[model samples]
Target: MCTNTKENDMDIYEFYSGRSFDAYRELGAHVKKEVTGKKTVVSGVEFVTYAPNALGVNVIGEFNDWNETVMERCYDGSFFKVFVPEARPGMMYKYKIYHRDGSSMEHCDPYGFGMELRPAFASIIRDMDTYRFHDAKWMKNRSVCQGSPLNIYEVHLGSWRTKPVFDEQGNPLTPEEIAESNRVAESWYTYKEIAPMLAEYVKEQGYNYVEFMPLSEHPSDQSWGYQNTGFFSPTSRYGTADDLKEMIDILHQHNIGTILDFVPVHFALDGYGLARYDGTALYEYPSNDVGYSEWGSMNFIHSKGEVRSFLQSAANYWLSEYHFDGLRMDAISRIIYWMGDESRGVNDRAVDFIRNMNQGLKDRHPSIILCAEDSTDFKGTTKETKYGGLGFDYKWDMGWMNDTLNFFRTLPFVRGEHYHDLTFSMMYNYNERYLLPLSHDEVVHGKATIIQKMAGMYEEKFPQAKALYAYMYAHPGKKLNFMGNEIGQFREWDEKREQDWDLLKYPNHDSFHQYMKALNKIYMKEPALSAWDDDPNGFAWILCGKENDVVYIFQREVNEDKVIVVLNLSGLVYKNYHFNYENGDTMKVLINSDWNKFGGSTKDTEKTIKGVNGDFGFDLPAFSGIYLKPVD
Candidate 1:
């Protein structure tokens, strides 16, 4: 074992001060090389860890037959290190920490880059430089995607699609036999295996980005990776760390941006994980009242400088090392307020940590996007941290999702009473640069799927859903839809099952898919809908006073490009419905949600109308939406 006196002291000081955003580079298991005299060289793996309260720490792994090798203490006896010449890439290892009271336990490395697949937990030594990225052009041109189109398809990687298990005869396994076997484990596609398939699907669906739910190592499959064990490690459920790099590289080559969901609030309570490292509550709160989250996990104690460094470093590691274009931070409300409860007042320390981390990340990567999945009414979520605000590029508009879905779920005859549900969003639309989301959270846990949440049964849901999407695209924000939503799947989202792909065999489902594709096309082609989304003047309500009519009219305009959107949510059709149009411009129908090709009653015909004497007239159909643009 050899010690390097040069950079160790400075790195440890920065780590303890919470200023080390790249702590993983210095703290994790890294292979080192030393030049001995003229051309002689020596190589070994160097392990480093921080356990301030521990009596001692030992390096134990495959290199030493799982035997404990005592590590040298340094810098006020808080940090430990050891060199193992036998250690190499692909070997599993862990730290054996000895407590002050003479107790001992083995814990995975806090900054490990790879982890063993659970029900087994071990940190794997990995060569971080093995995979060479070829995404220079994509990286050079990547931005925050502001003032541009950003339609994200949120996906849960494992359940997006599963491999079909086959028997020895090369036929697919019977449902019963598959169930009797370890089907869940057998059906997962490795990260490298799923890349091309996912790229093709996302491209065909016309989405510019894919936001993975979470890929951090967690013991339970049911948590959907929200509760994490290995903060810096990619989950072994998919493949190695390099395998994940290949997946991102493939997606980037296909001109698709990738976003990873990052959790900073809590961690899993697994015995071998970060729950009680060094036999103390080092990474989490000590008392259960504030320590345990609603999800039954340990809440991170962000007041500690080490924990702050660890979380931010992990966030930076994904963007810097794995080449993710963005990170959508999960549950910001919990970070802003204790247990996400406003009544508990604000968490000032956690709030400060967020600002500092975001500012630091922005300084490092100016082009990458940092979004928040925050539901709180916290001010300045998307504002720059230098201006006393959270430095996020975008924030999810949870209010709009709730109000709109609730309005759609109400019976149509009574919908007039809730007309403002559609209009209320505009009142606060520009509060933070928003991204309207129909995410996985809305379609799970006994809540119905987006399609099933519509007011009526069978045939009636299609037109309303079509109309709802048109409104969503027309609204002043970016977009994100869960994996199964575009196909109008009736089943709720489940982590274990793939989306109902067979649903597309039916006409209603197939037509909806086509409609979604066409809608995406229009959204992409029309700059008016997205180019000036954050500008207050970009959208205007042309007609919204008649609540009893249940008809809403709006216009979105950018520069010389403009589009008028009309929606009639009631069951009654209005013939020659006249609305004021001061410009008296000739208009052509762009996309009618009631068109026959999209499973609607109206014939597939392009209709044109002219505004005369400051009034424009058109036939309005029930449960329909129409987009019209002035003829050039």
Candidate 2:
């Protein structure tokens, strides 16, 4: 059961359902009401819009009149939004729209808090009081959801694999009909058929989380799941909302966690389900300058009261309804574009939106993990909400990815291959609050395959090539490797074709995949490898030298129980590595990359060595890595 406390520190919870956060931390959640001028107003929310088309708009709610809470008569059309009222806990009502041509919109409830359960009149009446214990249960269950070295498997259901679509009633829906429904997700996948496979495979290979690429309902197919049409509704393409829930449930059962890539930054261009659903701007930006996005997504006017309330509620809804453990808010930096101040500065509006959403979750579920993908210079964007920053568990590390790729793309011995780029990656890896990413963006659309990238450098320089894979496991933060990366897949990832199975038939190429499998196994066994999976304290840098082979890192959590990965980039074996630690002297031989077990020559095997010190060293075989433990 969720804890009952008006004010309490967030608690960690675990269950088959996704993790939730306690909402009490979010004052906005408890907002009986607030007039902007009354407090130290945080950005990300306001009470204004640019509805030039609507003939007349009015604010309606439980406070105005129970049965006739419609505000149509009081509206002047431009932007008629009501601010948060004092002590109006869980206001539930909809806009009474007045259209042009002498027509009064009836049976129209855009922006309804809880809709009617009947057809044509969507039930929007959701009593805030009914959702009790969201934080407590959420916190407790998050404890059950363990964090490990993350290798995200980014998936878009419509195009992730291939499946069928069904109507709300469980009947088959034709492709053409689904297409006409204005839903962007024309692709599909059955949870029963996919989750188990993905879970089992991920666990077998050593990935910790699966980032479901934008599961929220949308209206564009070719645009991918980026354009959200319904923030609350799961796309009807792959399966029903219930099916998506079960899919996550099964993934958890398999000991794997899930990451929901949420897109509150903007709505779909068409704005079918979420856009103008309230007959006015319920979720668009305050104006085009702030709401318009590069991708044509309907920008959420983060500077409005109603939109702010709606987004915060939507964040909680997934946790309350579908059990989403975490959220990866897509393209947050672009949500609010700023013309003044620094070019990279984020609009203050985004700050408030993120803060309220996170606070609400923490109030009800402390165990909830929240991540945002931002490309702007939003300082402290991932700090604690109380610190006046967006309260997020983590943010995508695009800087590291870009730098590492630049280095990986370079041929060994090339001027750019100077340890500078690799060294730069290590320096900037932890620049953000949290990071664990391996998206389809790198492989698809002609970005080149991971194997191909390595082949560019490693094909001729096997030792350096092997170093890339080894360091990924050896790094001291959350890690993200795609599906085929576990075993070497030669070609880039493609939905249209199968992974490079032909390469596996050959001894050398097959060994690369086998080598990757061994790497994952050893990686999972090491605490150092997973320390940065969620928290900020899991990693630290020990050494960064001009020599590529001379770099050293500490997973901070390394202990006697862990499997220490030691690799040498030298072509010839190096003997008697200078020891650094001051621990016991015998080292346990775990496994070696050069061993035939991974399709390599048996160059050398690790022998237990004594250790205990601030610094440690080992004898490494040429072009290989070995796992070990300390012994007396």
lDDT per residue for candidate 2 within 324-380, as digits (tens), equals 677778777665345323566756665666677677776776766687786565666
RMSD of each: 2.1, 11.0
Task: List the candidates' TM-scores in order.
Answer: 0.96, 0.69
Which stretches of candidate 1 lie above 4 Å from their native place?
7-10, 33-42, 167-171, 174-181
- Candidate 2 stretches greater than 4 Å from native: 1-98, 101-141, 144-152, 158-187, 271-282, 335-344, 415-417, 425-432, 455-466, 490-510, 532-543, 546-584, 589-591, 603-623
lDDT for model 1, on a 0 to 1 scale? 0.90
What lDDT, from 0 to 1, does candidate 2 have?
0.54
- Which 10 residues in a row give candidate 2 its minimum summed lDDT? 9-18
Instruction: Give model 2's TM-score versus the native structure.
Output: 0.69
User: Which candidate has the highest TM-score of all?
Assistant: 1
Best by lDDT: 1
Clashes of each: 0, 72
